[model samples]
Target: MRKLAALTTLALFGLSGAALAQEVTLRAVTSFAEKTTYSRGFERFIERVNETGKGIIRINYIGGPKAMPPFEVGNALKNGVVDIANVTGAFYTNVMPEADAWKLRQVPMAEVRKNGGFDYMAAIYAQKMNAIFLANFVGDNPFHLYLNKKITGPDMAGLKLRITPVYRDFFQAQGATVVQTAPGEVYTALERGVVDGYGWPITGIFDLGWHEKTKYRVDPGFYTAEVSALVNKTTWDKLTPQQKAILQKAGEEAEKEGVAEFAKLNAEDTEKQAKAGIEAIKFDAANTKLFLDKAYEAGWAGIIRQSPEHGPKLRGFFSKAN
Candidate 1:
């Protein structure tokens, strides 16, 4: 009787361990600071997952470089160090050179949001990266010229402008000396007069306090930046069908909330920037048309010549959306 009791106890303990192993907790990382719009969306995603996951699955967010650098997020996810990450599509251009084709193409946010482009991109990302694309949030803030001195038109020929690769050629073509600088270093560069201006997302200027060093803001509305949230394939595969369903439902909820939040915050921030005394320059009709035409021509032509395979699909997607 004592031997039978011992065996039954061991069996029950083993079953308990097995049951505990089935409940999973996932880690997600992102490069956005806690105050940034991206972080807000991430918070919403986490809330949705927790509310609907029924305690079977949990997601713990690790924000910014404190967890992992923006560029390293993909590698972290793949290695199982982190189960998910949020990243800008532009940052992964090195891994998928064809990614630049998607970033550079000028597609109106409204049209892209209405069409099935987000779903299509999600599918492509999943197939290529062996991860589930959770959401594609539209960043509406345009890359603007933040200058130290007020200048009209593109004739400020000698101005040294700090820019990323996407805008490097465009700025050079406009007669500005281009200086490549990371987002974090822009303020010091501007204060020290290493560059006359920096081309950046308008929100970044405010977020990083670069607005304190600059006076003018130009709204050329050149192109939009694409940001995405992805989950690891291994982690996703391990999820039960019920868990997967919960995550998918949460992702869709986050998408709607994110789009609305971004739109509202963008408008409010623009107003705040204006009130803070930063001069806002809206390109006149002629300049707007000229800028868009030249930008599209240079951007698309360069992508097709460089990444022929993915370039055509990217062009088709943008063209249809436009």
Candidate 2:
């Protein structure tokens, strides 16, 4: 009788352990194609999470644009169609216009987290988008103008270029005729002369072979790329404390790794682009000042225009304190 009772208790304990070990999978999507470093960093983040989490949490990464349009993924996350998303500020701005402040972030991601900026932005994200702000994977590598021909003077006269929200206003201020083309279409557009140039991160042009059509990179890159990860609030609230800690640790590690990796890739790829005949066009001192000044102004102008009441306060946190 004693032996049978002990065996029954052991069986119950085994069943309980199995139940606790059940895998928790989260579905995720990205705006970038798998070929892009944005998605590569994303994959690394997931790998770290799974390794440390040990089956407590697993993210099932869904396809990119094929799974959902780049602009639509944020909405999908909000509606619980996906638990997480790797999205860009350009698309996320549609859901939370204040997200544009990310473009104006003067400090590093780690610094932002340390300085209370991360939590401040996260609150706005939760309030406005009903989502959790994870981390900025595409860090520090600023956006630059890519052109087929060298840009002369401060003016972008007679240039028709592709633009993302990060630079659309700034490019327009320089007198360029801006064309909005999807990333997948940029190579074809440039090859066939649908557009003369485009603005993109200093890295990742080779992933889509855009560097083949692009010949010159304008110096003094502006605005961080603003690539970020997000989680659905409902999904976030459901996570166990341990599970949440795993994800946050993974995100923090990925954020630091991304900045270092991008710095290396930026130098190596820029050298390669130079070897392949892509020239770095440097503006004269006066034009350089004007270009940078206009870039910052245009970025802030858009933010304030979209959210007059909150823009100044939001920008204050990202910017140097007065």
For each candidate in the order shown, give its overall lDDT on alpha carbons: 0.69, 0.83
lDDT tens digits, residues 1-322, model 2? 9988866976877666445546689998988887577788888888888788786899888868888888788788888899988888787667888886788888778778888777887888888888998878876788889998777666888899898677777888888999876687898999899888998988888888887788898987878777778999999998988888998888877778888888898888889889888999998889888888888888888889898977887677687655
Please give each candidate's TM-score.
0.83, 0.92
Judge candidate 2 against the unseen true structure and give its global Cα lDDT, from 0 to 1.
0.83
Give candidate 1 misplaced runs (Cα > 4 Å).
1-10, 14-21, 101-124, 320-322
Q: Lowest-scoring 10 consecutive residues by lDDT in candidate 1?
A: 93-102
Look at candidate 1 and give me any clashing residue pairs. Answer: none
Model 2 RMSD vs true structure: 3.9
Whole-model lDDT, model 1: 0.69
Across 1-322, the per-residue lDDT of candidate 1 in tens digits comes to 9988866976877656335546678898875666565566776777778777756788887667666666666667656788877776555554454555555635554465557655565565666666777765544545667787777665558889987666666777778898775566778998899998888665545777877888887777566665667788888998988888888787777666655666776688778888888887667888878877776676677667766766676777776444
